[model samples]
Target: MAARYLVSPRGGRRAYPDITSALRAAEARGRAALIEIAPGHYEEALTVRGEIRLAAAEGPGSVLVSRPRGAVLDAFGAVSVHGLTLAGRDAAVDIVGCHTGTLTLDRTEIRAHDGVAVHGRPHTSVTLRDSVVLYGRTVFTGSAGLIERCRFTDAANNAIAAIEGARVTVRGSRIEGSRIHGLRVCDAQAEIVGCEVTGTGQAAVVADTRGELAVTECAISATHAEGILFIEQSRGSVDRTTVTDALHGIVTKSGAGPVVRGSVFADCRDTGINVQDAGLGTFENCRVTHARNVAVFSTKGGAPEVRDCLVSGGNVGIAVTEGGRGRFARIGVEDLAGTALRVYDEASAAFEDVRVERCPAGLEARGNGGTTAEVTGAVFRDISLGAVAIDGQSRVTLRNVTAERGVMGFAVSGEAMLQVTDSEVAGVSGGGFAALGSGRLVARNITVTGSEGLGAFGTGSAYVDITDGTFTDCAVAASFDEKAAGRLVDCVVNGTSGVAVRHNGLVDLVSLRTSLPVVRHKEKPAAPPQIVQVLNNPVFNGPVFNGPVHDVQLAWNNGHVVQQQTEGDGTHP
Candidate 1:
């Protein structure tokens, strides 16, 4: 085995005073000398060969290499560069075609011009550790290399491109201030961890893969497109990550879906997660909030498993259309402008322990959609309009859902059938349940409570079987209006005027149960509670919030989101 060579800029009294002369002398020495560069501006393009160890004192200010006209450094054979600066260059630091060798850089700085960077392809191992690649434009390619703990800034185009069959691993780094994508992985398997990518025109990480790609402990923000995107046969996963201030928080291109877990998506213009085509994955233990369009979009294609997620502040929480399905488990969706979990267009959905709250219309099904939309053990509270609206002949099965404070708790319009069993509806604004058009309602063991407006209003509905239910504290607990008959069996109506019928209507009352809110007169009401909890994460805070202020979700979420809080042991759930 051959020994390592060195190239220094300084020399002894008998030798030269700069690195070029020292390198020439070391070449005369046949090999094996450690080249340590001092703090000086090297204004020349350097070319190195053989097995060499290249180093510098500290960062770019210490040993700066400035070649503005062209490339600064070129190397061959097995080489390692540490703490060197290739600055003021208008071209690439070409590594050429190194064969059967390892090229490594530690704490080096590369500031190149448009369409330039270290292009070493189809060769040996290349690594950059704790480096910086800044102020580069990419008409050709800015970066196609393996890097870690790096920072890329002020990119005019695509910052980094992982070519076909490239193994690019970017960890504990940042990609920001880009005119285009921060990281573009094309036909490669990528693994990115603990990184922050922001300020892009398109996307943060566009991983075009043939297989698996993983991004863990990262933050993606302020992109026009999705924050994390996977295209073509690529499977993606994100754990303990955050995406904010994006047009779409996450998107999977055609034929790809990612397993997203332990993440947060906030303030997206479109959906939190958009699946464009066909694939299958899972999203567990995530939070999607402040979405303007839809929270979770399984619309175009690709059915994914969603579980243990909290979704709030959106138009539609989960919209499954265009032949997509979902296995939803333990999810809570609230405060929507439109419906919550709208499944239509031949999309099948299943909900297990899901909560939909505070929406205008919740759980709407239209256009022959959702064959297996079975709701089990869920809660719907503080709804404004319709808790569960059905249209276009959708078949839905409900089990043990509590709907409180809504205009119409259940409205099965458009000739739809609803098989509801063991549910409670309380404090509804308009009515407890309403069924319009010809449909079948097989309701068993239901409780309607607190002032139902024409408690059970139906028209053109089929024979209703109201078996084993209770009604409490409501005036006109049961009523039928236009095109239905009344079937009163073993039913109980407490504190209500008797059932009313109007205009060829139908009434079916089996049983009912009601309860009132406990009245408590307090001496003083507590002060209005703060809505947001102050974040205490100190990582990447950059002198602890001394940097520029970014978004409003960190500031005005009830005033405590941006404020610094005392150190309380924050264990994330």
Candidate 2:
């Protein structure tokens, strides 16, 4: 008659365009009818129950359901809620017990309360697209569901909670600003892919008591707690994801350890990635930067395998502390302000084939009592302080290494046993070997060269041995630290200032020389140490061999010592 469809409400009417009347006329017993809702505000809750197509004529903005309390569509089979705004100020749209029917909610607004709770029965399929479910808890406890391209913000509710089910996928969704976890899965087979979760109290993604949660290729950041927290028997692996700006990057606790691989974790207040003792895990090929504590911490009796990682500019790169141990292979630690490698406080760990570069004090073994550490084939360069600092009064053994550019090749300050052999300490700032405190250092075949300080400084070293070694231009002043006792035998300082001194402790003296005069040995050259290396040497000794020694008056005996090595067979001409 007058260009009209039909709208079914609870009551019936005639002669006028009454939705209640249309619904009462179009009912086909157990079957449902299609009623197109008109645009504008419906002040009361439209209760559509069981098998009906309630289509909104206008868009979400034009069709508003201002219901105070009630499920908008409490239906059974083939119920579709499309393009409608269900504004429950303090209530909710409880999608209770929906089974078999594929509910498509497109461009729909489910605001406040708890948005779109799919509960009760299993095998309930829900495909929500292009929707905004805000200020409510978007929970899916049913089996086999998907929420794609939807935005969920539950300020006063638990964000996106999926529990006690299987085969759930939440993809391409933006979830933020929640009270609890932004996206949490408990006892569910949940996979969050390409989703951006941020600004939450807990983690961006939390897997607690969940069954095999796989978070792949997602960006998670800016949380009050940790970025991604896996705890309580949750076995979830985060692969190739970037998590930053959180309290902790990833916290795997409660006897649960996740395989975290190829991820970037940055700007965390605590450890970049922490695998607690309740969990045993593995970290491979991950880069962590700028952390307050350690970049990686394996704590609490948990064993972790860390390999092929680059850890730089932190206190400690990979810390295996508090009963945590690991196998570190081909890992590198560079530019550390403190000790690069630390085996701390009753911790037992091993390093095989590791590279430490430009550390202040290369390797330290202190506070490690009853703790064992073994380093094999380790190489260090540009050690700003000491190549190796032995402390904590423990026994540490290193086999076949090279330490260069530091105060000493080896500096000991603890009571421990060191077996260092077939090593080289070259171009050091001080002695080639310095023993400060109480320790037992047994080194052999150690080549020492270019030492700007003493060849060795011993303070309280008990048993020290240096055999079959070459000391060239080294040990200018032996017996350096008078407070220690040690011995160096069969070692030669062949270059310059070669002499062993004895001041306080037993500093056995080894004497050598760098005093050879040149100009007198040249035949036709009557000048003196001719200054070929420094050709213009008129002011060398206020007595510049100016007494007509020519090249032959090399011995001035001017009450001072001068060195000249011009390589013309000790000639001045």
| Top candidate when judged by lDDT against the true structure | 1
Q: Mind giving the per-residue lDDT tens digits that candidate 1 earns over 431-451? A: 776677776566778878884
Q: What TM-score would every model get versus the actual structure?
A: 0.79, 0.76
Q: Give per-residue CA lDDT, model 2, range 78-132, as digits (tens).
A: 6667777766654334633355555556777767664554332366666667878
- Residue 414 Cα positional deviation in candidate 1, in Å, after optimal superposition: 1.7
Q: Weakest 10 consecutive residues, lDDT, candidate 1?
A: 514-523
Q: Give residue 354's error in model 1 in angstroms.
A: 1.1
In TM-score terms, candidate 2 sits at 0.76
Clashes in predicted model 2: 14
